[model samples]
Target chain A: MTALASLTNHQVRLAQRLVGAPTRDNWSFTTEPVQEPAEGGVLVKTLALSLDPAMRGWMNEGKSYIPPVGIGEVMRAGGIGRVVASKNPAFAVGDTVSGGLGVQEYLLIPQDQINRNGLFRIDLRAGSLTQWLNVLGMPGMTGYFGLMDVGQPKPGETVVISGAAGAVGQTVGQIARIKGCRVVGIAGGQAKCDWVVKELGFDACIDYKAGDVKAGLKEHCPKGVDVYFDNVGGEILDAVLARLARGARIIICGAISQYNNTTPVQGPKNYLSLLVNRARMEGIVVFDYADRYPVAVAEMAGYLKDGRMKSREDVVAGGVAAFPEALAKLFTGENFGKLVLQVASE
Target chain B: MTALASLTNHQVRLAQRLVGAPTRDNWSFTTEPVQEPAEGGVLVKTLALSLDPAMRGWMNEGKSYIPPVGIGEVMRAGGIGRVVASKNPAFAVGDTVSGGLGVQEYLLIPQDQINRNGLFRIDLRAGSLTQWLNVLGMPGMTGYFGLMDVGQPKPGETVVISGAAGAVGQTVGQIARIKGCRVVGIAGGQAKCDWVVKELGFDACIDYKAGDVKAGLKEHCPKGVDVYFDNVGGEILDAVLARLARGARIIICGAISQYNNTTPVQGPKNYLSLLVNRARMEGIVVFDYADRYPVAVAEMAGYLKDGRMKSREDVVAGGVAAFPEALAKLFTGENFGKLVLQVASE
Candidate 1:
């Protein structure tokens, strides 16, 4: 503990703003000696980090829901960590914490940045560290609020989700199913599709890579989709838009499919279907619903305990060095579940 | 009056479903002898018909908000008419009415079809015949509900409207202004642009033909657009989307620009702006608001009488014979304001 300042902390920093998809060369790996926390501050050692599709948007230099990750800065990420040292009475050493820990081996959060970083202790008894980074992390909050608030699924209504095997998609599907809504998933592969249905308890899963999405939607959602949770926006959005029941709700969560395009995103040409059906398309950011996260966390944690819900994380090991490849897997659909970078062993 | 049954009712019927924009060959001129009213029915003489962008959608072969106009059927339309004779106690011979009058000189509403056609007495003392076809008709109902309900503009917020001088656009801008929002309009030509700003009291009007709409919106709406009434879709819709304020509301009314496209409609490429700004995009079909039309009509009628609202109709003469040309003017952006087919003089 006396030699904490001598511990070298490794990090992956943005080398430049991304043009299309981020590559290895887009980031630079560096290391800096750790520093002791000043008065009323905390030092956290990263254990695991959640790699999300939204990170692709953060690499782009533009106005967005949040500020862009600037060049020469450590890439922003949400993760589970342990307090290595604490100078504040509110937190103590060895407490398991969750926060915007960045793609780094360690994070030094000043007293003023405590609230800004959204640092909080995680109850490991409820879920493991990987589970915390999966269904109990930022993605969980996003899917919870986006579906429960924006999607507003009523029991017996049909809810279709794109990227249904991914982080937010998994949570959205399980929650909708729990709410007694018919859950249909759209995933890139048959394995993913099968998993969402056979494992996650989705009513049906459409293998978008192997089959026609429009035809599958028509087959599964005979009455038309009442709530569509769109993660991969583009053709799938149009497909769902064309099959919406009157007064359907579409939750715009993320668009991994369009995030890496060099050209502009292909907007849903069938958007006028919203008019024909008198429907709505709304955007949801998890950060906005931060205040009510405890209520959601408590409810989902119960689901995890009772076996009514499950979570999977495609944990890629190699610490901070694996982040570049880990983030890239999101766009290629290579990662089978929540892509989490395992920064260190628990 | 006894010769009413002998009078020839000049009509325009759909020759075939249109491939893109309707042309002269797409319609056929026909005539039929006017029939006497059956029991519980009324006969109406068409005074003026509203030519709208939604008509283009009605001509296509598919399911829409309303069923497609069948081949060889009279082109469906809404018009201001006068009852020439009536057997129903609900209507008198001299009553002015508004309903789906079709592209014909006279319509004989049978006993069961009166409610289906939406025939209702129109108060001419509130607005003239052309005004009834423009601001007091379907377009007015569309603009009123779309702007007020879907837009939900707050006081001092910025509202950007496309097709500024058109029937729906004019009504939307005036109402947004009346609601104390800063109004900006996107129009086609200089004349229309000048009229929206100088006459209709919009803060600024963008001439899409002469200038860049994105830049114009940036200049006029320094605080960003809070409410957008999209009449002309395509590029103009994208422009307003690019300048959305946080929590903005977009009302999807009509896409006049894409209605006649031989190619697929170009979707708004900047639609992700909805996500970045935490805004919403909702579509409103005026038919959905029919139960509340009387409330909207009464409010807008008061605005017209008090001079807080104004209307302009570019009435094309030669009755139903000029239907094809008048309808074409909408796609070509030739009409100055509301394009109305003047079937006869009241």
Candidate 2:
């Protein structure tokens, strides 16, 4: 983490604007000298990278939560790191922190943006450094609030979740179980589905890719789905819409399946059921409830401590170069649970 | 008032089913002699008939709130009448009542069906009989609860309503005003626009036929709309969706513009904004809140008495023969307010 090593930093940059779906060729890895920390900045060596499905939406040339990474800029992502150098009073040398370090070996983060928003004190002993980006990080917070605050899971209510064994999905199912709801997960295959029911204690798991989801869901959820926590939106969403119980609520946490879609996203054809059953379908962004993060984090952490909440980390090794492939795991459903890229040695 | 009109009579039969839209040609205005009331049955002499846009949806060959009016039976509607005779011990002759008496001069209502649901009993002296069918009735209850419960208006928020000068729209805007919100209305013409702003005290009004609604809305509600009480749907909905503030709520009371469409209801093109803004759009059936009607009616009545609320009745003077044309007025927005047919004298 010396000046000499930082000078040879190789960073991945957006080589060309994606006309349609992004391919591996769109990124360029080049070595460049990392500059010294400015008056109110800190130089950090990337230790871990958080690969999120939201990165795809950020790459698209349209309005979203955040703007698209410019053609020659470093790919935007969250990364856990150690402050190798600093000009700020709060962050000193060797302080373990998280920030928007991008797809790079080193980052010069501004002082003002280095607090609770992105950069947080890391506890390596709690689980693993990767777990910070998984169980205790953005995906965990998303699952916690999206289910607890928005899904409003009541005891004995049948809760169905799409992308059930993935990052946010894994935590969502466990949380629902903790709240005394009959949690049913919709995952991809026998292996992942088995893990959800066995490891996560979900009441049932549907291999959405293996059989007819609508029929499978109906068979499992005889009372009908009271809360549908949707992540992967498409035909699966349409299937869930059909089986919604009276006063059901569909929570649109994320739509990973439709994010990389080349064409426009299709509306759920069976939305009229919202009228028939007097149900509601609502979209939510995590940032809207940022103020309540500590409340959600504390509750989720308590479950994590008592073995009530199970955590899964689909960790991809080989540092920042591993980010792009790790992110792709979400769309392809390749990763088993929370997808995170190990950037540097502990 | 005895059994002279015998056999609990005077029913209008639906002679034919509607092929596309129900017109005069699709109906036969024939009457049958009244049938005698069975034990615990109350005979109602129909006074005022409520004509609603939902009647058109009922005529279509699909599932809705109530079954399609049978080809050989009387058309269903909410009506206020005088209970000329009742066999049930709880009811006596000359008790003013309101119930689904079908579109006819006289109806032999079952005491269990009417009395069990508490469908009858009205104090005519408190408000005009027509007002019960307007502001103090279903339309008023719909506008009141649909906005307050679903829309959840906050003080200083801006509310924009489509079909703004119509029965529900006018009431919704007035209620938003009562909640300390700025209100803007959308109607079809200059006259309706003038009535909404000048008479109803809506802060601003937009004539959809006169200018660009999206632009007009931007100019008027500079802060962006928080609650959209939509009665007329389609393009106006799209325009409203584009200008919604963050965390806005859309109350789908009724979609008058798209009711008669032979094709499927197309999803809004700008619906992604809901995800972007983290907003909610909910469809409501007033009957879902039937238990709370008396509470809503009493509050709305208070508003009516205090001069904070006014009911506008577009009374088409005629008997059951005027039913076809009176129903058509809703689709064309020809009826300025609550469209009612004066079926008989009180």
Q: In terms of lDDT, which candidate is strongest?
A: 1
Cα displacement (angstroms), candidate 2, residue A161, comes to 0.9
Alpha carbon lDDT of each predicted model: 0.91, 0.81
Q: Write the per-residue lDDT of candidate 2 for residues A60-85, one digit (tens) a residue.
A: 67666567888889898787888888
Poorest stretch of ten by lDDT in candidate 2 chain A = A1-10
Superposed Cα deviation of residue A243, candidate 2 (Å): 2.5
lDDT of 1 by residue, A71-190 (tens): 999999999999999998888999999999999999999999999999999899988888888778888999999999888899999999999999999999999999999999999998
| TM per candidate | 0.99, 0.91
Question: Candidate 2 deviates by what RMSD?
Answer: 3.0
Q: How many clashes in candidate 1?
A: 0
* Clashing residue pairs in candidate 1 (N, C-alpha, C atoms within 3 angstroms): none
Query: Which portions of model 2 miss their true places by more than 4 Å?
Result: A1-6, A15-19, A25-30, A38-40, A61-63, A87-89, B6-20, B23-30, B59-73, B88-92, B116-118
What TM-score, to 2 decimal places, does chain A of model 1 have?
0.99
